[model samples]
Target: MLEEAEFDRDDAAPIDMLESYFAAHGWSHERDDDEIVAKVKGSWAEYELRAIWREDDNVLQFLAFPDVRVADERRATIYETMGLVNEQLWIGHFELWSTSGILLYRHAAMIDGEGGGTLTLDQAEMLIESAIDECERFYPVFQFVLWGGKTPKEAIAASLIETQGEA
Candidate 1:
């Protein structure tokens, strides 16, 4: 059985690290009120990378898709199947960060049955990249990036995100 973990919003925001990561990689960060949003678009329409940092720990990231938008569609089904009525599952990489600048967890939109647990920074990086590599099976062209602590939403989202392309 999975052990229940405590989630504190004041100690786990991954956006701080993300901002540093992007800047180190030559991406710029644009502040938008409480959210910091950024986009990198290449010649190919599908080569765009969009990301947003909201509050202390909510980071949403997404890669543009040339084909059907799989995240939105899959998320709708998952929400309906699980009977979630209060939240909207938008397409892309949706992540919620806690306050400590650590990636409490993350997941993609649409692909349900995500799996996650507390992880070190290195572990989080590896898992996130692995999740992206597996996206082809579920959404021909989809990539989601997320950052967040273990809130209920984050937990559920993480599970669904991990299950996206599993056999």
Candidate 2:
């Protein structure tokens, strides 16, 4: 028989920290067990973001699903595009949920002090912000491949902006 993990009441749990973090940012969110669900509006589209706390691993994983869904026929191309996009990202990577054909941007942060250390609000905010920024940055490229019928290489090439100089 496995025993349930015990957490200190005096200190806020990881989920609680995440909830408070989102609220501070003025974002509406829901907390269910170990998962925090929130909607973030980006330049490209609104995303459904979920943050899951894994006690055993001491890792908080964030996943954001874009409003667009890839058709079965386009999965291969989209997946290829994702491969190229993932390389340019500093924090998270985009992936396709094969079973549902949904594209998701994912990133995880290791919550330090797992034994007794608390996860600071600053750390939580950083994790969420990084994921959102990465998703918004590459969202258009994904759309170009899925709906615009652009090849993976072409879509990626077009998304790269060549800054000329200060005008």
Candidate 3:
């Protein structure tokens, strides 16, 4: 679990940059040295966005966990759905945390520069925005499988139905 960061805003830490981004977006967030967690409201549900920065490896991993929970019985179905869902995604992939069976979207980016791996505000915004977009787009498909008892293919199909126009 990441704790609230205690440092001057001028600090050059990547997590601090993210803290400023969250603040600008009016999202609640907490940050430690290596990780920062933010709560963002999406169209379907709230999301817990966790970003871990590794200065040594010059990498950043971003994860978005929707409020949806996969039940023990639904794990098999969700797992199958996970594979199919990942097939359609271009940015990141979805997975179920083995221990908790929690569904989450994950993406990792390699940051390389001569001086160091510096995280820019624009990069942070893009990473988080994409994650939130993917989650909102897919949350209903997970719901379709979980409660609607729809097959993986069926759930994906239902989610793709394009409404013609305004009702």
Q: Write the per-residue lDDT of candidate 1 for residues 1-167, one digit (tens) a residue.
A: 11113222211234443444345445555654333333433332322233343332333343323222324424433333223312333322323122322111124322111222112234334433433332332221122222222334444454455445657
Candidate 2 C-alpha lDDT tens digits along 52-103: 8888788888888887788899888887898899889888788988898888
Give the poorly placed runs of model 1, Cα more than 4 Å off.
1-13, 28-67, 70-120, 141-167
List all candidate RMSDs to the true structure.
15.0, 7.1, 5.2
Q: Tens digit of lDDT per residue, candidate 3, span 1-167?
A: 11224323332557777887787678999989899999988888889999999887888899999987787888999999989889988888999987887899999987765546667655676788889988988898999999997898999999978889899
lDDT agreement with native, every candidate: 0.33, 0.77, 0.83
Q: What is the lDDT of residue 47 in candidate 2?
A: 81
Candidate 3: where is the Cα deviation over 4 Å?
A: 1-12, 164-167
- Candidates ranked by lDDT: 3, 2, 1
Each model's TM-score? 0.30, 0.84, 0.87
Name the better of 1 and 3 by lDDT.
3
Lowest-sum lDDT 10-residue window in model 1: 1-10
